[model samples]
Target: MPLKTVNVGLIQQACGADRNTNLAESINGIRELAEHGAELIVLPELHAHSYFCQLEDPTSFNLAEPIPGPTTDALGAIARELGVVIVASVFERRAAGLYHNTAVVLERDGHIAGTYRKMHIPDHPGYYEKYHFTPGDLGFTPIDTSVGRLGVLASWDQWFPEAARLMALAGADLLLYPTAIGWNPDDEEEERQRQWEAWIIAQRAHAIANGIPVVVCNRVGSEDDPSGQTPGISFWGTSFIVGPQGEWLGTASAEEPATLVAEVDLSRSEEVRQAWPYLRDRRIDAYAGLLKRYLDR
Candidate 1:
């Protein structure tokens, strides 16, 4: 089905030590964006609490809540009131010792449409996700929503192309990434620039290669290590909306809070695919190497 222009809101903000304040701030941001004609709004990953992964304490598990829990209940009403679809990322406490990073889609009327669990959990410094989240077994499935198909993924999932392609193959018009990526405060300026560039370039390549719009909602500001273990990552707030052809509709600056609105002409996906024909001319018959654990022989 061909889609018309869809307006998206990228809520970029820095998290605070208070979860209530952060959640309230994010909800307000979404409503404000909706007021400004944002039909679909996406917020940063785990926007509720501070970047809790800064520490590895079992007590931090308190930050994890159920999907229909407090955050959804609050945000759903906002979506229903504004009649806007919301792509919200949260830390899910499925059960004791069973937590997952989940992205829940609330349709325009606030109905719980569906969800995509974060497939790739990262264990790098300042981001100890693997310590808490069990890697998602839901695979790479796109959820259907009132606005359009929402291809949702959490922070670490943003780097993988296979995840994006699977979503595109499953009929995703735009890829949504609720990310919590950043540079370490201690890193040199040059190293920080290189890391940030790599993050943006990788996602752009995903959009260009998959021929789909990519929207990433990333956090900004410097989070102090609550656990005092590793320093927190200074989230570069370049949350962007890239076209199927990888054109930047709009992007946020690296050190500020802002609401970014981008217009997506969803019909261009078909046009670009038709021109490149990359998906059509694929030799899927002989690409079995991709499934192998390691092709090193």
Candidate 2:
């Protein structure tokens, strides 16, 4: 039986140039968190290498690897050794020319639990993900693990309420986001602060609306752009966990690599839902127009 109260670990760390070094850093963090009583550990998105979506280059595809290849094998071993569940994000090489931003969930026994492919692909100045990854076809489905049912969404997918609601309706116990979002070098400090605040507020809203806890593990440190066309992005770490009522359980530093572990009482969701009842108040019958791309006036 699953425990009523679970401890989750967020590994917010800097990515190194070498894939092996980055993997080793994440592994060390996971081991430490497991030793400190974390039953479920999560790493930031694409933790195997630096954020390479700054520019559109076909050569970047070489970084993508098969899901069950080297990355999963290494993380699986750690999960098995530590007897803890691990959620890891990776750039997946699905086929000869196909790729995806996929999150793999590993059970305590080192077996593959399930995978969540990132549905939303962002295409901005610093994030040119559309050039690399194809939009995930897996849909918004939750993955079952020893800890609980994990509704794993990639970074860009966090911005959509529809995605979160779908996961919640599917009976996900917790919402998890393995993220790699950061500040654009040219943005003003004021704007950067607001952007970060919005990101946190949005996720908190999801927690309150769904009556489930939310976990976000983000990357930290600055990675330079190899092509020199633009200043590199400085990733704001700030990994956090929130309760069912949107109360913060714990948060990491915004500028440092840190491991944050927090105990969450999963049963509290029932109490919060009884008082707030956002899910029960939702008008599921009146959302037919949501299927359209736009309802122009």
Candidate 3:
């Protein structure tokens, strides 16, 4: 299964405090992307609601919605109408006492393709995600979609190359991340630039290493914590699409809300992999340190 190019649509936008407004804006953006020749559209993490990680409140759990509930139904409808595949981040209410930060894929035919829960749930500082989401039990896997096998992961999961490798092993052609990451508004300019650059570099490296295209869609704008206890995160928009060899195809601005599109050729993946041969090497037999939490023994 060679993917030479993949057309990617990244929706970067400033999130509002209102959930309905955010979802509506996302829908409109998806429509616009489709109109502009985007076969697949990806939205930022927790786009339907404010990045609730800003605070730890029991009431915040109320934002979780059932997977096949209203949200999916609406998304499925949109996928069908636009005839485009969609990757959307969601706060999933798995059961009465279980929840996960999940990425849902809607195939072009309007059916629920598959889903990947967020594997790395960060619970540090302003990003208090573990309070709201259970770590993904499904492991690293790609969803089968009409456009392609989507290697969809959540915000924190993007940092790990192991996650991307597992998806590539599962025959993913495109890596999709629905992310909401930002710096503490008080950070020095240098620190902010470093964080943003590191993010883009890490994902592009994944594409180069795995011989697959990477699409990262992030939320823009600033959010203030309702608790007033901490300065909220200032989300760096900069949504991007990078080629298999770490080449930049297109990128959104730092603060603008836009539906960014880039055409991809899905047939080049096999070519790149053949030339690089990174995956075919035999380090698998000796590298067992990855399984341990730490090499404390």
In lDDT terms, which candidate is top?
2
> Clash number for every model?
0, 0, 12
Per-prediction TM-score to the true structure, in the order listed: 0.97, 0.98, 0.96
lDDT of every model, 2 decimals: 0.88, 0.94, 0.88
Ranking by lDDT: 2, 1, 3
> lDDT for model 1, on a 0 to 1 scale?
0.88
Indicate which candidate wins on TM-score. Answer: 2
**lDDT (Cα) of model 2:** 0.94
Clashing pairs in 1: none
Q: What is the per-residue lDDT of model 2 for residues 1-297, given as tens digits with 9 covering 90 to 100?
A: 344988999999999779999999999999899989999999999999999898898989999999898999999999999999999998999999999999999999999999999999999888999999999999999999888899999899989999999999998889999999889878999999999999999999999989999999999999988889888999999999999988999999999999999999888888888999988888889988999999989
Tens digits of lDDT, candidate 3, 1-297: 643455678899788878889989999999999989999999999889988877789998888999887778888999999899988888999998799998889889788889888999898889888888999998878887767788898889899998998998899888888999989988999999898889988999999989988899999998998888878878888999887898888999888898899998877787888999999994999879989878985
Error of 1 at 107 (Å): 0.7
Scanning candidate 2 in windows of ten residues, the lowest lDDT window is 1-10
Candidate 1 lDDT at 281 equals 85
